[model samples]
Target: HEAPSPEEHLQARTSPLRIEPPFCQQTDDFAHNSTLHGISHIFPYERGWIKRCLWVVFFLGSLTFLLFVCVDRIHFYLEYQHVTQLDEISTPAMVFPAVTFCNLNSFRFSRVTRNDLYHAGELLALLNQRYEIRDIHLVEDNVLEALKIKADFHNFKPRPFNMREFYDRTGHDIKDMLLACHFRGTECRPEDFQVVFTRYGKCYTFNAGNEGHTPLITTKGGMGNGLELMLDIQQDEYLPVWGETDETSFEAGIKVQIHSQEEPSFIDQLGFGVAPGFQTFVSCQEQRLIYLPPPWGDCKVTPMDSEFFESYGISACRIDCETRYLVENCNCRMVHMPGDAPYCTPELYKECADPALDFLVERDNDFCVCEMPCNMTRYSKELSFVKIPSKASAKYLAKKYNKSEQYIAENILVLDIFFEALNYETIEQKKAYEVAGLLGDIGGHMGLFIGASILTILELFDYIYEVIFPFSHVVYIGRNHYSKERGQYFTSLRKNCLLICSHIYQMLAL
Candidate 1:
């Protein structure tokens, strides 16, 4: 419709029309190309653009910032959780105390060491003599743990063992045909267990042992003198608790170790997961293997010959001053006949002296003579092998003797077991089947590397987000925020950066 004059249109429209601003700018003729008010002219436009840009950037930045904050907070929560989780089973520090640990090597009963036993090959050969076998396989394990015996001396090896060699790797041949069969397990992979020998912790080349959590002497006092808790025939169901992480609950932690006579788990592959074997040695022995108990009851003893002593991990060992049946002096001595044998006359003088008889005497003196560690079954026997007292008995003793319950429980009870073990009148010593302990390979670097790689990547992602997205500033348009308290903030930032770097490094490693 054609509008009237400007004055008439103004008069007709009573409802004041909303006026839209002009899209283009206007200027006077005097305003030259070098306009002085151009900035002023663009000021309003810039304000509008600035506001819109600010809204968009700040909105996106706030969202991203919120998401990042949530992520970081969650990360910290999880990190603390994981740290706490790990705290339960924190890597077991060297808990094997220097207390003269009762080495199985010295036990009069299981007194067989690396030198005392036949090789797996010999045993296999014996089996060959009995049965027709296609290929006789012998897995070897050393009895006289060269390592455990010399643990006190050095942690250095001038020449490292080639872990892949045949002769060096073969351990002492344990002659338990039954254990060998069981070790074969369900997996009949001949290649997997080719005379392979596994060792636990640092204890290696130990004396062969039979059954249950083999006892060792240590300083850790539990329930009583740590020795007694382990000896009694009475076994308790020790609740395995998480001993590693700081978590109060032991759901997944290394269990609290306790002494018991027979909790198959304790002596089996796993149990009170406190002690674990470290390096594994697979050995095959061919020659004669004979180990005599040292003058001292301790299985791991200093060798007389420095060279031979050094080979079994004993260094700087002098001849024990208390050695009565000195093997070094009686070399090539033959076993005396029945009449020629030294009579069992308990006298101060050396009544009888021969290799075989002295071997028995020396070991008896080293360990306990009257209280032998062998089979103590008969009632009339002097050494009973039943000293381990029941908890009720110990408790009764504790109440009666007015002693500490733990003292009664552990120390006295263990003494009781020892007392019982020694009661047999004639303890017959024989070679029994040995079940060996093998250390775990779980916590090593090579195993954790794969899993750690993934965690490192996630850590890196967090860092890169912080760096690229800029934790402080919301946008490049204008500096809206600044992270102060430089030390902590930067440290966190650095850690994130480092984590990311490590992740990248892992990828490279991969």
Candidate 2:
């Protein structure tokens, strides 16, 4: 080798770094003052101060980040668990429909008698003071049959006794008001009733049954002619409950029978769907009830009133052996019935407003599926209301108004279950227990469980520190002489968290 040139020697002496031997790794662990890459070149002795600072920041940041995630996940889990738990334990509630089961049905007469139930137009007038009842349905059945499915009472076995008749034979009218749990179903279903009279309205019903006897059969056919309900109304303002009027006769042509054939078998009509048995009320023809009022005695009967009612061919009055008020055969509007009474009460409306006593609807065993969706009419004139479809969606609404689905579909106003909900307070409870077999809360602590699970997941994250760090740094991870171009560093995440907390406090103060 030739001797080094003078210029090369000069360059070496003037150079700030050595190009030969080991290269210094300044990216990590060493500064440019002393101990550079394990060589005492220009690595800084206090370089560890910066390193320690960075390490501390990174560790704290990562821990803070991880903690925040843990809190968020736990909160989410708790909320979810709460909802799930409620779902798991939910139960449905139901209602009843009748008083007795056996004698009311059986396809056989079973020694039962027929009694015509009449509408007292006066009663409607009385009710109008509180409600804006403009329309009425004209029919021969009880308000129950016209509005909803009938109820059922099992082993109830009520014995009929007329107080007047008893007094004639043994002396004394039934002192106690006949009462019974006349509404019940064998299965878990929705069975309820309602009375449409306005609050504090004066409406009276005729009693057709009594209790305290063994054989429900009328041995001597405890006789009676028909019933007449009386009403004192503002004819020009309020309307009848429901009935028909013949355009020609002006008197609705409702037929009447005196406990004889050619008339609807009152006993036969009793059952779970139509006229419930053991209950004081039963189904009857509107026209039949139109007559049969005693012009003398307690009722102050007026024959002229009968003539005017009869002239319309919609309502009238007649007489019978015992006592009778006047039955207003006229109804404001009439609609068909839907399905038989079910055993469930809807979860809408005030408790007292429940159809169990608030509506005039009657559930029956008739071919409701076919007869449903029937047109609503009054006094033989077509009405705005139409029939409902046999589908459940339709029927469900019908049950709410205590009318047939066929009727509900037509009165779309009531279809908004939420809207109707406001009409009544204390909705009937639905029994989630029977159907879903829910025992307690629907889903047990689902949110808590989910939160716990999220906690577990967070606990398993090994890179949590990095996530919590406020910032990351890159550095070579090899020895002083080794060179790795890039490495990562973590920075404090808690700083940002503290900032957020401080901001929240500021906002609250403001």
Per-residue lDDT of model 2, residues 1-510, tens digit only: 897544454443333323322223332222333221222222444557666666556545555654565565555444322111111111122110112211111111111112101111112221222222224344324433422221122333444433222112221111211111121111111111111111111111122122332211111111121121111111111222342311011111111111211111122122122111111223321111111112111222333332222221111111110001111111111111111222111111112122322222244223111111111111111112222234656657557546554433332221000010111112111222231222112222222222223333344352344333312211211232123222211112244445557767888999
Candidate 1: regions farther than 4 A off:
1-49, 71-81, 85-263, 266-510
TM-score for all models, in order of appearance: 0.16, 0.18
Worst 10 residues of 2 by lDDT: 414-423
lDDT at 255 for candidate 1?
Answer: 20
lDDT of 1 by residue, 329-398 (tens): 3322121111122222111112223233435534555531222211111121121224324555656756
Shift of residue 432 alpha carbon in model 1, Å = 49
